[model samples]
Target: MASINQLTFIKPKQFEWHEVPAPTLQNDGEAIVKPLAVTRCDLDLYMASGMYPMQGPFAFGHEIAGEVVEVGDGVKGFAPGDRVIVPFQINCGACDNCRRGFTNACTSVEPFAAYGFAPTGERKWGGGLSDLVNVPFADAMLVKIPDAVSITGAAAISDNAGDGYRTVAEPLKQRPGADILIVAGLAQSVGLFSVQAARALGAGRIVYRDYDAGRLAKAKALGAEVIETQYSPDLRATEEFPIVVEAAGLPDALTFAIRSTQPCGICSGVSAGMSNQAKVPLRSMYMKGITYTIGRVHARTEIDHLLDCAHCGTINPDDVITRSVPFSQAADAMMDPDIKIVFERD
Candidate 1:
């Protein structure tokens, strides 16, 4: 049996390359893929640093852009050598939830069956950091990378970019050219991606708020009006917006996001590591008739649209990728404080 090296998380702030059995197509719907570019998700950094509680000894990547090396007999949409984007979550694509565009809550697989992390169910789907990965439901799970998009730049589209897309896509559709407010501080990629996504989606006047000078600079470079500020739980937003996004995973940031939404406006939170017990201003929400949405992203549903944007050169992932390194430097890149990093293989 052929084996490949996989990046595995051993403990907080620790990871190693380990040899693991390479995967093959188990059924006609499955396909074998070789990851070419993998980007770090904000959750990866949090989990690796012990900021987020997650057990390790699990394979370590989820966001990836890869090439199909082999396809099962039933696989029709893809063939060997096709460059593709693989969504983080596993879904059968034919299930009720998936058909309804809720791929995040796919009914065909055990709840939360995802790549790049520990097994949540009986099956262990390997992470994207491996030399090769097995993708079940190939036709349903894979989206070919656009010819106009850079393979390395599109890597984060697997998760973070899609997550960022959802922040502004629907809201902008509801109110085209509306100005948006994004509260970003902790993580760098998602918020920056949101700014670009909003621009592509026809949003007007993107205002990004964060205390990190580095992130603010990145936001400004990405065409967002940057606001520098500190986080406080009691913080109140002085400006109002029809669309608000909270990317900073802090209770204070969430509160500020809600306060910033105008009456009948919508707020989406892409933050992780927020306390479950955080309070919402129900009275204000009811009086203002505002809607707040927060949860895991249905990444598969938005891939094509984001790719379309990428195709037209409206949003370039390279703008947000602060660092790009060869695969051998994965360990060192993961520990560094760079805003966004991409690990690529030749």
Candidate 2:
């Protein structure tokens, strides 16, 4: 077995370099991949903050874009050296949920076990942050990376970008051309994607509110109308946007989003905030007839549409990636707030 290097979060505020055996074909349908690029999810912060119910000494991270290094004998439709993006959520395409277009919720794997969490397959294969990873049900889980997309750019799309697209675009099918309000955090990737996704959905107007000036600047550069923190106290007075997206991972932001949305409007809560309980104004939401949708993303349903938008130049998600760091520095890069960081091996 070949030795591989990996980053492990042994405890909160602690990370150590460890030498582990490289992953090999564990099943006839599995594939081994060398990550071309990887990234940290906002939920990682929750785990580090001791807010999430995650066990320690586990591999962390989910978003990955990589080159296929090896494929098991049973695998078809993919070959070695193919570049692909591994979505954080794994699924078997043959399952009923997957056939119904819910790949993220596939029944073959343990509930919510992807990269950065516990092992779901035969081996304890971790996320893309490692030198090599084993992807179970490879034929169903991998998507070929487009030639036009850079590895760093494609990395973001695997998770947050896809998430932002699903949160707004999927809901918009039921409510088209509705105004959008995104209450996001400046420190995370979701805010940046929210800015781009809203525009691609033909939103009548997009309003973004964040505490970070740097993020607000980026949002403005992306053509989103910026609402600074000073205006947050009176977010309800600005305008009644029918669609609201809560990506900040903060409970307060969710509350604000619920209050700002109009009656019969939809508020998509995409944050994985550690808090189990949220204080919502039930009376207000009930009286105003507001609707709320929350939980993990459904990216497979929207990836094709998002790719079409990207191919036609209707959306440019690459703009949200502010920095690309080498895989060695990913740990430090994630701690920095100045830029949205993407990790590349080469």
Candidate 3:
């Protein structure tokens, strides 16, 4: 039996690195991966603290830039000793959804086939923080990390960073040459990702509103004008925007995004923790003709464009990673107060 150390939950809000069965090739198309760099999600905090749902034998994490160690006979486009980024979502490329380029909603895998945080399919696949992970559809899901981009930096693209690119790319199609407004927060680092994505997508202008002074400074460093909305919840710029990205998954943040959007504008929210039941201004949204899009992302679909941005130094998610710890220290790294943590070896 192939077993290795992986992070698993012993109790709610607690984790430890324990040796478990390393991921095996369950199918002919499967591949085994060893994470060179992995990260914790903002949602992981909620799951760890029992704020969200939980079940037995909880596995943690999904963001990773990993090295391929083994490939099955059917695997294509990858082999042993190749560096790659494993998307947080599990997808089979030949499925109907994937054939149409919507890999996030692929049907070959069970619906909501994703890794980590007490979600379903725990027994079927391993999490990103594990010493080894089994990838079911290697050709479809695995994206090569560009030569110029460091593995640590590429780790973020497995989820947060790639979603950031999609967050703006979806809206830009509707309103070309328009500006974008991002209501960002610490949830999942999507906030900072929005700032980075908007700039790379060639928005006419970008404005980031966040309560965190430090995050605001980081936004400025990313070439976005900043609005410090800490003490003032009702505050907003007088001018509205054509594309508004609500990356902050906080209560009333959606309301604010809807209110601040220009009439007939597009507002896309990246936060998954949003309440299905809440005080949403539906009437206002209808009256303004706002188009609101929210849900999980197809990280692999948007990875190529992000790869270009990273290779040329257009954006640096590594700078946003405030903490770097060894893989043995990953469980402890989750307790960090920093914006982001990347687990790597010395």
Best lDDT goes to which candidate?
A: 1
Better lDDT candidate (2, 3)? 3
| Model 2 lDDT at residue 126 | 83
Return whichever of 1 and 3 wins on lDDT: 1
Q: Model-by-model lDDT, in order? A: 0.89, 0.76, 0.79
Give the per-residue lDDT digits (tens) of candidate 3, residues 19-128.
78777787889898888888666677666666655674756778888999999999879999999999888888787788777878888767777877555543556678
**Span of ten consecutive residues with least summed lDDT in model 2:** 229-238
In candidate 1, position 294 carries an lDDT of 86
Ordered list by lDDT, greatest first:
1, 3, 2
Residue 95 of model 3 has an lDDT of: 76
- Candidate 2, residues 143-176, lDDT tens digits: the string is 8877777677667777778888877886677888
Model 3 residue pairs with clashes = 13-48
The lDDT of model 1 is 0.89
CA shift of 324, model 1, Å? 0.8
Candidate 1's residue-wise lDDT over 1-346, tens digit each? 9999998988888889999988988999999999999998888887788877678789988998999999999999999999999998998899999999999999988988899888888888988888999999999999998888888777888889888999999999899999999999765689999999998888999999998999999999989999998989778788999999999988888778889999999999886444557777899899999999988999898787788889989988888988887887787678778888888984
Best of the candidates, TM-score? 1
Candidate order (TM-score):
1, 3, 2
Runs with alpha carbons beyond 4 Å of true place in candidate 2? 49-53, 119-123, 230-237
